[model samples]
Target: MATPDPSITTWEGIGHGGGLYEQGYIGMAHGWSTGIVSLMSNYVLGVVPTTPGLETWILRWAKGRVGTPQGAIEVHWTLGEDAMSVHLTVPAGTKVNVQVPVKKGQFVLLNGEQIEALIEEGYVNIGDVKSGVYTADVRQRGSVACKPG
Candidate 1:
């Protein structure tokens, strides 16, 4: 079966009622809100954890969609003097992709080392990755000033 376009579908709410025999009534429906939230987190944010305790991570900018039209997810926090890190988990055997904001002359570091990346439209694209927990650190011109905080 084909999935309906959520943008134009009318979300129907399940209802419950009772007569002289039943003593329960239905509450207002809120499925629409739930579906929207799922779409954003699963498709837009694309940060899915597979392991029960978040032992594996998957970083996909936008999956099953053309673009992030809703804007990218941003997190800002300080780390001991000059350290910043992000964490995520994904299921095993699943291909993962990550989108990192980048500029010319900058590179991506997987584990304190530089790796070949595709630079496009002010973003660094990493693809063909498998399921696993990952921590990435970005540096510009050999400087750590641009690290996430």
Candidate 2:
């Protein structure tokens, strides 16, 4: 009779129950669990950005083909006096059918009236008043644009 190594026995017990084998599998599982945990934690903590001078907005757009699992699309944009940044996340089954126009000082008028006209016209007029960065984020399912007041 020989004694089995504790580490090997433990590994075998865990692995016998359809456990991960390679280190890469464990790492990937950890990463996914971490992401889910973080998202849940944020929701539980009510960690939303709220400030007078800073604005945080979330828009959920559903349209064409995207690359995510929920068939939903997320687009992020930030506009300030000197810079603008944009990021887009699209799920796997949706398609984004809008063309985002980007130009300096081009404001996205989200009013129903303005949006209707712009959608019909396919474009909007932009004038040069002050020099600032403009950003446009477009994906297969949605788009988002923002500017600081």
Candidate 3:
């Protein structure tokens, strides 16, 4: 059942239904979950994987949209049982680029470590690669740093 007000998009979930509407009803507040995950991964945690199977990756945090008075965000994650935990953080007005699973002799650092690149498939590629969250800030105007060997 819905209210008479057309502007009121909120509604109660009905236990009986099928397909998309049924799924939506089953998880009436699913958007909140997705939104929180998106905020943490894209804006707060800032973890973006590049290449298939996360062969490469990048991290960039946004302090403005975090809705907190603080000017930085901390991120922590684990890789495997043998690998050590990885932790990173970024403050307001700071820029950083990280690439994972990099191969030797494939990338070149230019402009006093402000730029990172490599020739992939005969193409000169830059930073902010793709896989999970897309970071336009790095691609637009930000320094690039390759993964340490």
Candidate 4:
């Protein structure tokens, strides 16, 4: 039964087994368990596999560290008014794609160098980025011409 304050109650809702009110106090908070695991893996750890067997993957570029068979991958980013500064460390032999949020026609930069491609579908699609530490930053169009690389 819910108390008037609700916060003062000893139990929350019915038990996992469904409405056995007499002995309904199940121990674990199920919702929080899922949040701590699933949410942590996707957003914080930023580990979303795009291909099977980890041959290639997508890095969402949020924060935190994750370990793969090659080694450890760590990413940290700082958001600014018009750009984001990302410091990334990828395991050797890994090839991953990086997605940065942006509007179409906007430009993207890695280590202060402009990328030739424009943003598509609300993101700048940077693909097949090799393993290594990098300083990535984004710049808008008209700031600098994209150099042929």
Candidate 5:
């Protein structure tokens, strides 16, 4: 079977008593679904450069995956009874500050291993991270949520 071409197919409201409807045409797409794609890719994930470009930046790690020219960044996480597990990806050629709210004693689990970090004002700043994927288990009290990690 063959499907009719959309341009020739009569859409709904074609007979709703209108001038354009009599011609069987409609408006073009506005791309509203992804209107925030750039915003999510660049700003929400922390590619909005402190500098003019992405030589250096701050990343507020939320759970999602996005790609940039600098590199592809990804984050995944799960909540445990007493801790939170996070998976993260850093872009290449750029130094980023990743801070999250989790603490196990004085260190956090980087790739299922312990690593030293800076904890201030209920935020744990992970150590200098290389460009790669890592599974991190951090410590925190109550609901461990953060925009930095």
Candidate 6:
């Protein structure tokens, strides 16, 4: 729950069935491309890096000063079922925080709050479940999605 501060700068989006989303790249490079497109689309277990070379894995950190670049994503599963989706175009005074993790039995749906609010907001809808595994954390302006479920 707490252990996501390795000097930051972490990105790993591997999708194409084997969903995996990890984000952490705060300030700079447009905040790591707005936190890797809101943690590869709303969070792991719903992997979506928009394909195409997948931005070559993505692990960034080239000195600070970035001020607006932040990213975090993580995804882990063991069984069947998988779903990941992502889409963000923020920039006009942006602010987004989408975090989903409700495991004990399993069941999570995002539509209005549970921590779903975007300012200058563009688009954010999440999905994950069908077997057991969940972890979706999205922070905007300085992006982030600490994947794994």
What is the C-alpha local distance difference test score of each model?
Answer: 0.50, 0.37, 0.40, 0.66, 0.60, 0.34
lDDT by residue for model 4 (14-50), tens: 5456544547456433453345555676678677777
Q: Compose the digit string of candidate 2's lDDT tens values, residues 1-149.
A: 01154433223113444554563254323333345444643454334445543366332221222344655455555444433334444455444443445443343443111232242243433332122222342222123443323
TM-score for candidate 6: 0.16
Put down candidate 6 lDDT per residue, 1-149, tens digits, no spaces: 11255653343333345433333333312344346556644354344345575663432111111134433232332222233322222223434454332322233323212334332223333432232223333333222333332
Models ranked on TM-score:
4, 5, 1, 2, 3, 6
How big is the positional error of residue 70 in model 3, measured in Å on the Cα after superposition?
A: 14
* Candidate 1: Cα lDDT at 40: 70
Better of 5 and 6 by TM-score: 5
Q: What does candidate 1 score in Cα RMSD to the true structure? A: 12.6
Best-matching candidate per lDDT: 4
Task: Summing lDDT over every window of 10 consecutive residues in candidate 6, give the lowest-scoring window.
Answer: 58-67
Residue 20, model 6, lDDT: 36
TM-score of 5: 0.47
Clashes by residue pair, model 4: none
Top-TM-score candidate index: 4
Which parts of model 4 have CA positions greater than 4 angstroms off?
1-62, 142-149
Clashes of each: 6, 15, 0, 0, 8, 40
User: What is the alpha-carbon lDDT for the whole of candidate 5?
Assistant: 0.60
